[model samples]
Target: MAATVNIRRDVRDSFYRYKMPVLLTKIEGKGNGIKTVFPNMADVARALNRPASYPTKYFGCELGAQATFNDDTERYIVNGAHDQNRMRELLDGFIDRFVLCQSCKNPETELLVSRDGYITADCKACGYHGDIDMRHKLTTFISKNPPKKAGKKGKKGAAGADSIAGQPGQVDGVEDEDNDDDELTRKIREGAEKVMTEEEAARLIAEREKADDWAEEDTSPEAMARRMAALGVSADSSLLAGDGDDDDEAAGPYGEFAAWVSEQKGQDANGLSAAELYKEADARGVTKKPHRLLPVLFPALFDEKVNAELPKYLPVLAKLNTSEKTVKALGGGIEKLVEAYPDTIKAVPKILMTLYQADVMDEDAIRHFATHVSKKYVSKDLSKKVRKAADPILQWLDEADSEEEDEESESE
Candidate 1:
């Protein structure tokens, strides 16, 4: 019977596509001279597309033990009586750091040795090229003993010869025919060079001069506009009128709010109060169109312990969420916050519940927000966390609707 296990712990399916041989650990020696041997290290490393020495060395480094790999004997050993589970855990860490692509998380990667003596992993699956952590002890070893490049095969022909005998314009075992062909080829080239007339030479020279002159022409905006007009194409001046400052002005309110929030990072919010901030925002006309301020306000107003003091800001946020656009903006801002600080916003359900209870987010909006899943804010894992956090609110809303239906049915 074949023993197999999923490549990663996160993949729980018994029939997962990625499977590897179960770790086979054997203890050797006794007392202080204890050593662990991986008999099928070659096969396991082959499955991972890495050298057996890498994982073996990694185990040594992590466990503070000595490791050895004998290429001739294909033996890998670590100077400790480590259990199979512990070795497998260490191997997973190695795979996460060296084998997997940071961007796509795929294991189809090749280690590249740079000219500057740094190692990078180039992924074949997603074409992602990322620098490997140089801090690892294995990096130094990999740098010293880089993977060899595949050699090209030599063409099956005599040295300095283009074609073989009996092929186009060649005779079998004749050196004179090859030499005569070379001489005749040189003569044909010399005769062809003399065929050009003086007028044709002058015309060629004139065309060259014209090309050089065009190459040296000015490429400024006005010059380009004039050139386009000369070529019978229209150029619109209005398209390039802006001074590239509109985007900067558009971020003014959000930027100011963010700056204010940063300034209040460590201070006690009890002194300043959310009502004071709301009043100040209203004074600055930021509260009039709160959707524009939400992206900045949400993160600024709350931290990881948002649920503890969320009720204080509920009234202010509810008042600001006067329209459908503002509600959607607030939802999007929460999503961004969750993405940026997944750990801090683990109480996402409580935040959403506060909004729903305060009448800021209606049933439709809450349902839509609960169903929406996007990778733009965070990775797949964190995205799932955010969605999972909303489950409680979804359940509450469903129960409320059911109660309302029950009342209607009783009245009928």
Candidate 2:
């Protein structure tokens, strides 16, 4: 029997049921033809419930070497001599990104590819459904070639099987054996059930369809280029879809205008002042649509330095908040900033406080924004993430409301 190790390297329990064969590599040939062959890659991939080609491709991407898989002989090869230890370390990174559940750290995740070419994960262990970071190069490959559906399990490879001790080649789906009830698991199931209820299912489906409106529908050359640009990837003609016809249609007036502003700022040594920005908008015939432009412009204007830019642009933002609609637009603009600069998610409370104090957005607008999520500017999931980061400010706002009510009652 080949030596096996825990699927999760950090899991040192001797009896851990999820196991895979320890990596075995052999360096072949010499000079230019020299390569590393993973002898038992099929067994390891079977244990992880992933295609052998995936890890092979991942190794190629990470090592900057050419990886090839021969279907006839089921051979996996990388065109460079790689040590077992180095390959094992890279395997850990693969497990972290593709195998382990984001919420539970279990290896029971199923990759879900959306029609829009995005990859998400569904954890059977903890019922966490979340987007996998699309920034990785491997995601593009995974999205193009999704996993094949498994056949019905036999008794030996059953879902309830606790250990693969004797069957060293069995799949990894070890269920948690602890008898204690997990509150988080219970809540997640409850939430899922609520969404699936007959009365809400239709509404939920409609919302989901609406949310996908902004997602990519086809793999056209222009579409692929736009998606790659949004993901911060350089355009690669070989990897992209469609024939090499370059269609440079703008992503909409709002996004185009924001891009123009960013380009203009980059070209000019001295940044555009608030008045200069207003004048530029006037020249471009976009001053009337500040509501739409503001959301995309907010991030474009400040890049990642919102703290420094917010105060300087407060007067301009204050002037734009002339009505309730405009105030709500400002709130949406802040949400865009959070979406663009995820590190700013933690600073959501401070951002909201700054805008509120400056009268750019009123308390009522801020409270409403905190409670409601819109897919008009960003994805619903990103909106929820931003709100989650604003919990401290939300709680403070609630407490202040309660105190005001108490004071009014005492006066009466």
Candidate 3:
């Protein structure tokens, strides 16, 4: 028996269960006919739960050489005098692409080929099913010559029943089925026998206890925002408050404040009280930070009735918009309002006009909002919609500014 090593050669964990016979190569022929043969290709393929032809063809693709596999002789040959180390590296690449589960990085996965020539890896270890990268040359070959299905068992003494039984000393179709099951069972058994450290045992116990919570899906905006934060993607940071993790405090200056506002609004019949909101904002130390306040406040206070809600919230809005930056943030809040309630898009003109008349937003703020577009508050497409809906108001503002300039020039 050849020496066995971890399926992932890079993982140096001594207790790692998944193992495969190290690839054995023999250089044959001479000069122009020199070739490399993987003598134990069948054993390695069995360990990976993939066809021997896959890695064989993968080498050919990577080396730009012809590869041949004989089903009867179980011989795999690539038309080149490749070194053992180089072949081993290429095999590792093949395993990473075709064998390892994308979700868990485990070797316990089965390739599922669709009729549409798409390959999906179904991971037994993590119960994850994801599409495999179809750009590799092996995908085309696997799609054309898919893995063989195990033979079905019937009543005793029926034809081919012996093959399906996978009895001892059997090397037929039954061998494929039995070998795979044997590999998985051996891995599980080895993993089960390993001595667990106190920390690892405790962690596993905790995970098992909270498994139900982990299974529950959270599609709420706050959940989505936290997920986006984890991926380092930009979103309303204030929406990621109280993620129930250690990093909750890192969400942003206004995250906890926003969460508090959301909680109060949900409990109170009259919604967020202006006096309480001011105190809360001051306690959260964001009253002076209007640039952050407006973005979170708008989403928390108003909904689709923003056109009507604008006046109702005008007093609070006026208190927050104290500077040029806060005024621009107010503009961003309007965009966020439209994003959250797309139906309010047609009401954008009224909303902006109300804010303008109340002096919550100035001419420069409105002009800045009209000229700039960013996905910070809302998608560019939504921003465009909001700007389009507020176009009449924007045009009027531009004309008023032009008339003032004309009057100034005439007075000069």
Deviating ranges (above 4 Å) for candidate 3? 151-412
Candidate 2 local Cα displacement, residue 209, angstroms: 58
**Per-residue lDDT value at 129 in model 2:** 91
Which ranges of candidate 1 are over 4 A from the true structure? 1-250, 374-385
Global CA lDDT computed for model 2: 0.62
Total clashing pairs in model 2:
0
TM-scores for candidates 1 onward, in order: 0.37, 0.40, 0.39
**Model 2 Cα displacement at 61 (Å)?**
0.5
- What is the TM-score of candidate 3? 0.39
Please list the C-alpha lDDT of all candidates, in the order they appear: 0.58, 0.62, 0.63
Arrange candidates by TM-score, descending.
2, 3, 1
Estimate the TM-score for candidate 2. Answer: 0.40
Clash totals for all models, in order? Answer: 0, 0, 0
Q: Of the candidates shown, which would achieve the greatest TM-score relative to the real structure?
A: 2
Q: How well is each residue in 1-412 modelled by candidate 2, as lDDT tens digits?
A: 2345677889865435456766667778899999999877876776676788889899999999999997568799999888777888899899889888889787767788889999888876678999999998889999999987654321222112221211222322112323113222233344345434643767688678867884655545565456435522234444443222222112344455565566666677255665556545645755455565566567667656677666656545543444555556666777777766778777788887766543344355577788887876678998888777777877876786675455334323
lDDT, residue 197, candidate 1:
43
C-alpha RMSD in Å of predicted model 2 compared with the true structure = 26.1
